[model samples]
Target chain A: MQSDNPTAAILVIGDEILSGRTREGNAHHLAQVLNATGFDLREIRVVSDDQDQIVAAVRALDGSLGGAFDLLFTSGGIGPTHDDITADAVAAAHGTTVVVDAGARALLQARCDRMGLELTPNRLRMARIPVGATLIDNAVSAAPGFSIGQTHVMAGVPEVFRGMVDWLIPKLPGGRPVQSLSVEVRRGESDVAEPLAELAREFSDLSLGSYPFHDERGWGTNLVVRGLDAARVAEAMHAVKQRLAL
Target chain B: MQSDNPTAAILVIGDEILSGRTREGNAHHLAQVLNATGFDLREIRVVSDDQDQIVAAVRALDGSLGGAFDLLFTSGGIGPTHDDITADAVAAAHGTTVVVDAGARALLQARCDRMGLELTPNRLRMARIPVGATLIDNAVSAAPGFSIGQTHVMAGVPEVFRGMVDWLIPKLPGGRPVQSLSVEVRRGESDVAEPLAELAREFSDLSLGSYPFHDERGWGTNLVVRGLDAARVAEAMHAVKQRLAL
Candidate 1:
């Protein structure tokens, strides 16, 4: 499904993530990537690594707000474990089974064989895919996350999970091709809002932003202009900079 | 305000975060922290550096699911800029004018003056607090985050925000003291579920968890037993380890 908003939502699971034991952080990076790609991030939910809860959250994200969003991402719970029931839950939500896909299974099996570890039945569960979904390749790890329809599944390990997201987003069909330029203006955003807003209005396509930072020189706001068109981005930045006289 | 199923939510603001340009990731870390503390993290949101959206998200999280959560955390937007509106929104949610707390102003002024910044009127905005809230100390950064009743506010930077979480959690009246023990058993979770469930039932107070990891040795599941009582946690882990023949 598609919408004018071009929005996305994230579902994060695992008791480790919720319990403070493991500091699992991937949603922020995902949201950042999606935002840069021009996808509006609408909702983010962190559920315990329960099959029913994962299924319910997937359904909810796809129900109404999900319809409003162009993409849905599920992070963590794709590993081979007793608790890792995300694949099963995804299948259950779509009324399918967690079966081994020939491609993912072959790749994982070869990986296991390379290391001389016998592929136990449970280990093979990592090969399971929701029926008819495309596999998202994890270059860092042999166990691949999958994308069945709009839902992009990925691992919980921050490093590996990021590889899957970087792989999946660029391959997708839609995004507003991000454009941005920043200038260091030695003033608070308040000192520059009037002219910046005028420039933002003038360049309707660009999404302008301001960020403050404290460097050795002192505090300054970095004004940025983003859009699909590069020349328009440059033009807006120039106008805003001229207005600030920085 | 305490219960068996504790719930928590977070609101992250800042255009730097929404834009992919800055890998803003503190919010995801906060979600994991709240979860580790046994709060069911219901929602995690990142709004642009815009005030209306910040106000709206804070109000919604404060009122959503029939106020299902015990706390709402807001990070960012408490800086010295027109763009930093988190303090205002928190104040707005409470229908109070955000005033520069005398202590807060004095503290921030001292820090800024020491750093050689002019302490402009805009810079003083960071000192604004919703009336009648206790300030959360920031060990890493002097500008403090605050807690107004159940709503705990924090900074956007990971180091400072995490420090604020540490300061805030220990101060809140104790919930059930969480305890945990784990052992890596060389098998998938499903392969171990039947016996694990029996163990879980035997130790009714403990929350059993299994995490699967792919090491060079092969697939191994980490079995963890958690509970309020340390003795119960030990008992459950002992049973689970014995069942796994570890």
Candidate 2:
């Protein structure tokens, strides 16, 4: 479906996720947030913590090679550890260098002082930012995320990622909020596929999706209609209900 | 760390996931299974149910453009609905055509007869397979998944996807299963970063990662050591614990 909404993609960088040690939550959280803010999320990619992989993914998503997204959000590999290489990878992708941002360093220094912890060089790694980037606020932790080019790099922790997204979404350029409505039918998806396809063709501007689920009540399909226009979304949902004789 | 294990990539095809309507579980499940079965999962990608995107991802993951994986597993978009276009996309990616397989048709026919349901055209869509592909058994449902080239296409349902993986993993070639050990230290990640980096450099064959978490007990780091050799992994973990004084 074509959308006037700005497009976005999420790049999740971590070995813990690739090894199945950590279930991914940041991408899903950002997806919902971006959807509500009316950005068309086109893709979500999970790559290892390897710098080359991170650079390739960031460049690909940022549209350096082809169709580019208006915004790219990355999670993971921004921690105060040896494996935290996102800042360097993102800088490499942008053809820039990583530098210590005074604002980020001050925040880290203040946080260390408040917690009675030494601001060691390892902890200072979090202060590094790509050149020509602005710091993104992190209310939970003082180590701020940063916006470099079209990409916003954030921490992988679920709480910190959510806080970064919450703090950053309001400042982004957004279109009209997307309106989504759904109707649950007890019939099989194939039983309604023909009519649903017809409805989808009729409302080409809206996105209609059929998701199957099985519960104690038995098999069912959730028919969802989403669009930037509230009335159009509601009208399409009503048609779905009527066509299915709900 | 370099290994002899066959590399693999997972492509998740669905708008539901990109829209945040469904939390991704299949990729994580597949990762753990592949890890245990001795496959190196290099990447996991989630793209909307767009034919062009699916074809491009399939080509890229299959290494038609560059470095190829030994196997590519795709989940979702195989249902009996209009949006279920994975089979067609995969066929196009291979420069082939989608045709109904006799074995698949027989399975679907038996399922319909047993369930006392009509074998409608939409239902028959599940029987269509890419030419020159073999069926991957799905114990949960009669609708069989297919493996074309190095790519195995499976259902989106968690139960069915797991069943397909169980049936397919043993049939594929694998190397030594990866051995992983972890030590949870009550110290912050920055406090342990320097020693961990030294250990990582010392044991260049093993992967050492430090993941930080915060709970009621306060902040701590989980030092994970992973490698193909059990002895090496154990040795790395020992070094990490000793270095961190855990």
Candidate 3:
């Protein structure tokens, strides 16, 4: 069956994330947003803030392997600092040049002027954009994100990234978002695998997942049924509830 | 200088994670543990539960690309269900076979016996291990994880994964753990990039990072210095503090 959902990939660039100095929250945030917006987030790669690694990841996600997504969202490493190398890496990936976008410069300038902030050369670094890209408005901060081809580059700050996502969602085409129904079962996943697998086979349209988690009491399973067809998903969830006697 | 730290990569396989039904906590937990155990976590990839993709990722992490790590830790997809294909994928990548290990079966049998549970066929599926593999004991759930050819496969359950990691850490050789110190300043990253970069260049042995975050008040930058030598790292942090006038 042909899938109508627009596929997307997320690339999180930072050394702090990889170093375990900071727990990553942006990927989870993006995944939820993409799912709500009807975009199939196929893959997520977290690479250090390195030029070569970022460039290679971008190219590979574009189509290097058998997998290629429609949209690519990259977060982090766009701030005004030496470690923020995402812009140059992205430009190198596209074989394009980085230039100061007039719109971005004006936005930066206006924010600086209003805040009584000096527009130092380092601060102006945020205005640099890859050639032939459109600016993604940052409502929280004046530093603008940019969209080149299918890739959208946004800030790593959750608030700024959220703002850019809210702005970009309406402009892109989306498919029917998948609706989900879940139920908690006290039994372990292995105890219910047979019946669950049978139900999964019965409802070929829906995606059934058995996730095992531990709480203060003991291990339990959460059965989730997801599909574009709400009725089918509901039907599967009902059948699962009956089979598990929940 | 020759580096003594063992490098590692984490591959997370699950549709729930990719679909945003679940937030990933195992990677962060593993990263902290690996760091504390003196291993360098170089890369992390989150792929859907696909057999070919899993096999390909295992191969690539072993040495296929120019980027090769000393160990590859995979979480999830090793369960008692049709979707549990990690064992087969790992065996395929290593040109080996998956068989029910006698020791693993004994472990499962003992747990089942103690819990007054029946050893169902589906539940027994957890005993299957790749050829020439060593079982990493799971103290929480009794389902043993395995290590085959530098690839360690464990359960997705955070509790189980953490238990297996704790069991595995002492068995592996460790290097000197990196020490880190951080200072937060109200100034923006751009305001400190020049001097910070200069300080970074002076301390060749240390890794200097400038992370920008927005709090309720306003934007601020956190300067972190990390190195193997405590004295050197402390020295670098002191210099950074002095350079930024913090």
Quote each prediction's TM-score. 0.75, 0.97, 0.96
User: For model 1, how does the per-residue alpha-carbon lDDT over A102-211 read when each residue is reduced to its tens digit?
Assistant: 89888878987997876766668888998878899966777889877677889887767888988888887656746678888886454665676577667766677677
Model 1: lDDT to the true structure: 0.71
The candidate that achieves the highest lDDT relative to the unseen native structure? 2
Ordering by lDDT: 2, 3, 1
Per-residue lDDT tens digits for candidate 3, residues B1-246, read: 114798888999998888887888899998888877788888888998778888888987865333378889999988888678888898888889999999999999999999999989888889999989999986788889999888989999988998998898889887878788999999778899899878877886678899988888898889998878888888988888887777
Worst 10 residues of 2 chain B by lDDT: B62-71
> How would the candidate models be sorted by TM-score, starting from the highest?
2, 3, 1
- Using TM-score as the measure, which candidate wins? 2
Q: Could you tell me the lDDT of residue A155 within candidate 1?
A: 88
Tell me the spans in candidate 2 whose CA falls farther than 4 Å from its real position.
A64-67, B64-67
Q: DockQ: which is higher, 1 or 2?
A: 2
lDDT string, candidate 2, B3-48, tens digits: 8998999999999999888899999999999898899999999999
Selected candidate, larger lDDT, 1 vs 3: 3
**Local error of candidate 3 at B161, Å?**
0.5
Which is better, 1 or 2, measured by lDDT?
A: 2
Q: On residues A67-164, what C-alpha lDDT tens digit does candidate 2 reach at each position?
A: 35778999988888878999999999998999989999999999999989888899999999999999999678788899988899999877788889
Model 1 pairs in collision:
A18-B35, A18-B36, A19-B35, A19-B36, A20-B36, A82-B189, A82-B190, B6-B40
